[model samples]
Target chain A: MVEILYFAWVRERIGLPREQVETNAATVADLVEELRAREERYAAAFADLSALRVALDQDLADFDASLDGVREVAFFPPMTGG
Target chain B: MDIRVQSAPFDFGAEAGAFATGHDNAGAVVTFAGIVRDDTGSLQRMVIEHYPGMTERALEKIAREATGRWDLKDCLIIHRHGDLAVGEMIMMVATAARHRKAAFEAAEYLMDFLKSRAPFWKKEITGSGTGWVASKDEDEAALGRWSKE
Candidate 1:
């Protein structure tokens, strides 16, 4: 099971901060595709691929990044920190 | 390098004064502080969220990078999360180096990276409603200057 975490507005839209997913997807994009098919909220939160940033196991990662052996993933909008 | 991520408010003057006092080897010291801005007077507070472990790791990594790139005597980064009222300090960066140029440049680099690469997100809450502060394109652009082309 891979842990999926959401943050900020994405969390607000998905109505969840984190979830566990049992998936056989090979990459972050594939996992996203699977989640998008689960419900309208997931689809809406991930509607625009350009607006989202993905991280695998707490490191910055691309959507096409391989998820082999990865135990955690996160999705969020661009950071506005300082 | 000293890095702090706290929800409690920090005393800016005391922190800055303390940071300046101990750098005997450093000829120049630079400090930068970011304040919650409420230009229209509508913002009640700004809530900042962060990925707990990653935030500290990211900050430390950035601090390490700055130390490597500059001849810095010391550096400090303090950022606050949770509810922050307008005029409150959000974060501060202090750098001490042998020369003014290195001190100034490293501090700017740290600020630029913290604004874009760090994992924190800010949301503005006002009487009208609440909304996330979108990342500025200029901030992303600011980081490009630090990268070697």
Candidate 2:
């Protein structure tokens, strides 16, 4: 099981902050595809992967990154901070 | 190096002063504070959201990179979260170095990286509605020069 977190608009669309999911996904991309298949809201949130950024275990990571032994994942849009 | 991510508003002048005094041997100190800007004249406030643990780590990494690239004596980064009105200071970066050039350059590097790399998200609440602030392509483009140099 891995903890999945959503932020900003992603959180707004999904209607929650974080969740624990049991999955057989091998990579971030596979997990995304699995989440996308869960429901329409998840589909909407993951509709365009390019519009999102993902962090694996608190470090920025590529969607194609392997999920081996990963405990936490967070998804959000590109930051606009300064 | 010092990094602070909090929802509480900070005193810009005081923080800047302390940072300089803390590194008296440094010949130059540079500080930059980002203010909440509402160009549409309809903004109510800006709500900043951040990933708690990741925010600090990302900022520290950025600061560490700046120090590695310059002769920095000390560095500080303070970014606020939650609701902020127009004209309020949202964040500040201070860099101290042996010379003006290094200090200025390092401060700029921190700002550019913080603009894109930080895990903070800003949402604008306006009279009409609320919306997330879109990340600018120009901000991403700004980093290209840093890597080349």
Q: Of the candidates shown, which would achieve the greatest lDDT relative to the real structure?
A: 2
- i-RMS, each model, one decimal: 0.6, 0.5
Distance (Å) between predicted and true CA of A42, model 2? 0.5
| Steric overlap count per candidate | 0, 0
- Cα lDDT tens digits, model 2, B79-114, are 999999999999999999999999999999999999
Give the per-residue lDDT digits (tens) of candidate 1, residues B7-119: 99999999999999978899999999999999778999999999887889889989999998997899999999999999999999999999999999999999999998889
Residue runs of model 1 more than 4 Å from their true location after superposition: none
**Chain A, model 2: TM:** 0.98
lDDT values, one for every candidate: 0.94, 0.95
How well is each residue in A1-82 modelled by candidate 2, as lDDT tens digits? 9999999999999999999999999999999999999999999999999899999999999999999999999999999888
**TM-score of candidate 1 to 2 decimals:** 0.98
Show where candidate 2 strays beyond 4 Å: none
Docking class of 1: high
